[model samples]
Target: MTLKQDTTSITTSISNPTLLAKVDQLRDLNIGQHVPLPQLVVVGDQSSGKSSLLESLSGVPFPKDQNLCTRHATQITSRRDKDECVHVRIIPGPRASEDHKKQVEAFQTKVSSASEFRDKFVDILKKANEKMGLRTDLSSGHGGAIFSEDVLKIEVHGPREDYLTIIDVPGIFRTTVHGTTKDDMVMVKNLVKRYIRDDRTIILAVLPSNVDIATQEILELAEEYDKNGKRTLGVLTKPDLVMEPTMRASVCDLVMGQKRPLTLGYFLVQNRSSDDGVKTVSELDQGLRIQPWSDLPKDRVGILALKEQLQSLLLDITRREFPKLVQDVASQIRQCTVELNKLGPSRQDEREQRSFLSRMAGIFQDRARAGLAADYNAHSSFNQTDLRLITHVVNLTDVFNADFQRLAHSRHFSSLEESQPLESPEPSDAGDRSESQSGLSVDTLRVLLEESGVDKISPKEQMELAEILVLPKDIPMPNEGFTDWIKEVYLQFRGLELGTFNPNLLSVAFTEQSRKWGDMTRIYMSRIIVTVHRFIAATLRSICPEEPTRIQLWAEILEGLLDCYRKAMAQADMLIQVQQRKQPYTLNRQFAADLSKSRGHRITALLRPKAKEDRRFAEPQYMVNLDDIAEAAEGKHNTELLQEEIHDILHAYYNLALDRYIDNIFQLAVDHSLLHGPDSPLKVFTQDWVLNLEARQLEDIAGETISEKKRRSRLSKKITDLHNALKILKSRDSY
Candidate 1:
């Protein structure tokens, strides 16, 4: 075949025989060690003619004696070629040591001619057994492995070759026999399962016609892996040994697919006999031309038909599985390439190490900026909640603001309860509101006057006096219940003035109101630090996938970021001390407006009594009168009014200060000092930072160790092999 192709169709399609050869080529590349490849795997119980079937198909002489059995798996690859050749070698198992692999790989030999391979092949099998540590002398005291996972690979080329690959494993055995130990039985079954479990493998279940077909273990296992018998092919051997009429009928039933049906049904074949030693297809067919066999289909009873069937089956599976195999190989190449890129170029010296650090620092800065800015499109990780620094910080500040607003106050403000006045029906709007109101009626009032044995008043006046007597008590002052406490605080900070008090009372009250700020701010600052910590950790992992290097960077960079957070927290505490411990002060205009607004509401409630029909609580009209003002100032209620004014002033200042402090904590403390700008925590990893590091520190951070060097070498070799495998799939071939 010639390897040349157009790029488009090469990736998407391949011809049947070429695809089959592609699988063989990949197997030769040892890609099967990394991924499953499509092939036929022959399996059966011991003495079930597994080796005999392989011999008939490959035209190889397999030893089938009463005392000897296959100890390890043998992989035979046959390809059609003009020149005849046979090459044999050993492929070590995964558990084999490096020294053992080198030892086994040297057992390669090329046969001069396929026609003259019988004598050399037997000697080669013996040498292969020795290499795998399988005992050659069953009678000798030299002990060896009962079963080996290592494979003996035989590649053959001849004019009559079919594009096929077959693996013949040691047959399953339920009990120990001959010189084999109990462990041998378990190892053999396990080896069979490892091959058959792969979905790409077609199971060749070899059954002897002389034994009960229902008693075979290999068919049961095939059913386990291939529930619908899709990939299982049944081969019936030793038909000549079944002499009885019933046994003959049973073999005929299986061959006709009347019992234990398989998707790729049974084939009956006769091996070269021990008596006459017949070795030709005609002689083998003559042995099967008996009562039941003669009546069976002509195509299902000979070695020639079995060979054609296997070749067709192998071709069909290759066509079905080649596309997926190519995809798997390509996908593995991409994954390995990404991992190799992550490891990056070697850092052999101080200059290279420093360069590596500088590059990584740049990546860190970019990702950190993107995360802090909430620019999720920059990296997929920015969309993740843990790495969303801006979103988390904003949400934390919102919660902090809400908690401060709700819990930072020393006393709760009472909402004014408006009185619902009952309106006596007006002349035109009669019963509009009175019908909805429930109050004393005129008839009940008159009955009460009569029962008191007093003179009866006029009906209208009686109703009016009854409504006036039933009017709810004047709406009480909002903080009248807290007056005692207010008086105590006022007296403690009293000055020489009669009604005015020292401003120290307002400051002390504010200090108590904001007592929880310190503890709450500490917790809030701690949560912000944690949020930044998680974001930085995620960013580092994204930029540096290698574990050792990431760990070193984390150890170097995290402490400096934490120190920044500590400084930011110290700044926040200083602001709290300025607001709480010092005399309260603010230039905000909202304080004056809020104080005026509160006093106006209180004065309106005090000046106007509850009106009978004033349900809207309308503002009372203000009239400037010197006499009325003098009377109010000298009245008995003046002290209470003064107390209310002081309370209003303190409350207004508290509202103004609350908003300012929350903003300062978020901006000055968290956003400015810790998260944003050139000297912020996000700027901790930079090219400048790397340049300042000493040579030893740079080496410690980025230098490769011995194990790391070995890993890099191993990955480089694996990536090379995978790339070659992809080229094999994409390269065009002409048969």
Candidate 2:
């Protein structure tokens, strides 16, 4: 293949002598094996003349039998050579065995004439079916289905052949046939879709002109994969069969780009019917030049026109996709290499197994350390928020302590002194006392009688008695004593009413407020455990890359580790619960001492004697001595002191309990569960434990399954193929 080289641009034309050669070079590179390559993919419903179109283009007689022809993908590469020859081979699918692939490719038959080529191709198909174990008959209903999605590659070189490569896939069917099921139909559609889905592929959606265009499944399928119709070309076959005038008009509309116009437009070609027998390209062309066939546009009515259109389309697509194709292959090579490296070197023997185990242990140990330390940045999988497991537990504990305090100081346990009523002012006059308001003395009665003239008294006697018994007109109302006011204030300050002083009340309130702490503790601990478990499982999968080992680690080993961690956390929670139930205790004595000092000062202020000048005239002139007042004052003071002491004690114990509970949770739940040596979850991956595993245990952990080996082999082969493809593309200096 040669090209009219230009550094700045690529101008492709079907008239260019070397254009087809360039495309043939691409096909020879097997670029399709690694990445999507530019090509023509023929798609149509059953018996839509797809095979005839291909045969007309390549000048080869493809099998015409419906059952045997085009059962699998047929890739034909045609090139011009002085010596005419045809070669056939099979490229097995990824699942096919090496022996089967060789056997299929080994069958070779060359033909010089179109008739010989037709017979040889049919024989090749029959031999391939038998060798590949594909069942062609379904009447007996005892074997596997007939068709496969593998490709049958044919390379033809002749002096008159145009250099081109085209793929022919199985015709799409709507329902099952004798040998086909619903699954077979689905398989055929998927196979066709896989090819047409590639952006690099130019789809030739063939339909018989007699059939409704809407009824052809290939057109719908093509539209789905090529919505813009940019890469799709409609090919209407059997146009000679459409005898009706309306059908001819519709065909003309489709061909003239009027009805459901595609970007590349449509081509109408008439192929020889099945009963017409084999004919040469010269005969077909001469026949097309006669009568009504010659009336249509010469460019749209012949196989020669269709071939030239396809050649131009293929060249244009190849030029457009060439640069992108190179980049895609290079990128795939890098990605596949990285993935293969990650799978690590194969472990086949004892020493290799030991090395693999050591590597896994190291990975597990490092991840475990990072998780326990809450160092989320150590791994890409963890984020800052996920690393706050311990901090969350600590915050939960703080909330619990605050709730306990709130309950302890609630209104139900408030001191009575804080709620006591204040003392009311004593009555200032006799009228102010309800009991003394109606009392009448003899002097009042005598005064009334004298005013009424009931009796007469001497002036001297009246004066002397008035001086002795009459009160001063300006006398001050009787005032309350300082001692009485002090006693009233003391009574109000006394703590605790009747039922509030019960110790059981404090216990009940504490219990009710702190009940959620246990549940919260368990939940927080469980969260931490789950986080660690996930971290370890993810780490194991990354390190080992084996499903069996991952399953075993989680089900057998890691589960036990989680159970142990759970039990430890539960025990720590139990300890906390027990401590909470104990009567609140504390070693702090400063609060009690401060309360005692405050009480002493209040007592001194109450008992101080009143000064002589400070005494009121209506109050007693001498010191008032009331034993009951002193006793009551002393009793109220004692009660206040006792209540203050109890409050101080409980407050101190609440703080101490919080400190101890926090310590216990950190030790048992966080540290013992994950960070503890020897008993820690990380211990499962220690070198000593892994190295000491028995043969059966080691096999269970690191052994490979037959399917896994095959998968790896396939991956390795694909990577190698990609590398080889990249080398070939890169070898072209212009690229």
Best by lDDT: 1
The CA lDDT of each predicted structure is 0.73, 0.62
Candidate 1 local lDDT, 1-735, one digit each (tens) = 111111111121223568887787787667887778888999999888887677766767777553346888888987768898898988887567779888888888898676567666677788888887777775554667667878888888876566678999999988766676677788888888888987888898999999998899999988888899988989899987898999989888888889988878899998764454536555566788877788989879887777667777777777788888889888887887777776787787889989999998898888877877788899776765667778667656655564566555555443322332211111222222231112434334334423432233346324423321122122211222344666678778777876676788878877876777777777677667666766777788877888998888877886677667667778788989988999988888999999888766654454444223434557753444455544544445656666777777877888898889998988888888778845577888899999999988887889888887776776787788888898988889655
- The reply for model 2, stretches above 4 Å from the true place, is 1-35, 94-119, 136-144, 173-183, 210-215, 239-250, 274-279, 330-353, 366-551, 554-684, 702-717, 733-735
Worst 10 residues of 1 by lDDT: 1-10
- Per residue, candidate 2 scores C-alpha lDDT tens digits across 1-735 of 111111221123345435344444445444565688888999998889988887777655666655566678888887656877777766676456788777766766566744456556667777766655667665446465567856777877666555678889988888777667888888889889988998899999998989999888888899898999998999888876878888888888887788999998888776666677556544565666654456667777666677778877888887787778778877877887776675576655667666677777887777667765667778775553334333333443343333333322222222223123222333343222222112443234333433432123236323422322222122233233323332343354545655235554345434543454565455445444544444455567656666775676455465456555656566656776776576654455754664455455444434434313336777545443465336535546554554444443443454455556656775765677555645666566666767787767665666556765666676687777766666655564431
User: What is the TM-score (0 to 1) of candidate 1?
Assistant: 0.63
Assess every candidate by TM-score: 0.63, 0.57
**Clash pairs, model 1 backbone:** none
Q: What does the lDDT come to for candidate 1?
A: 0.73
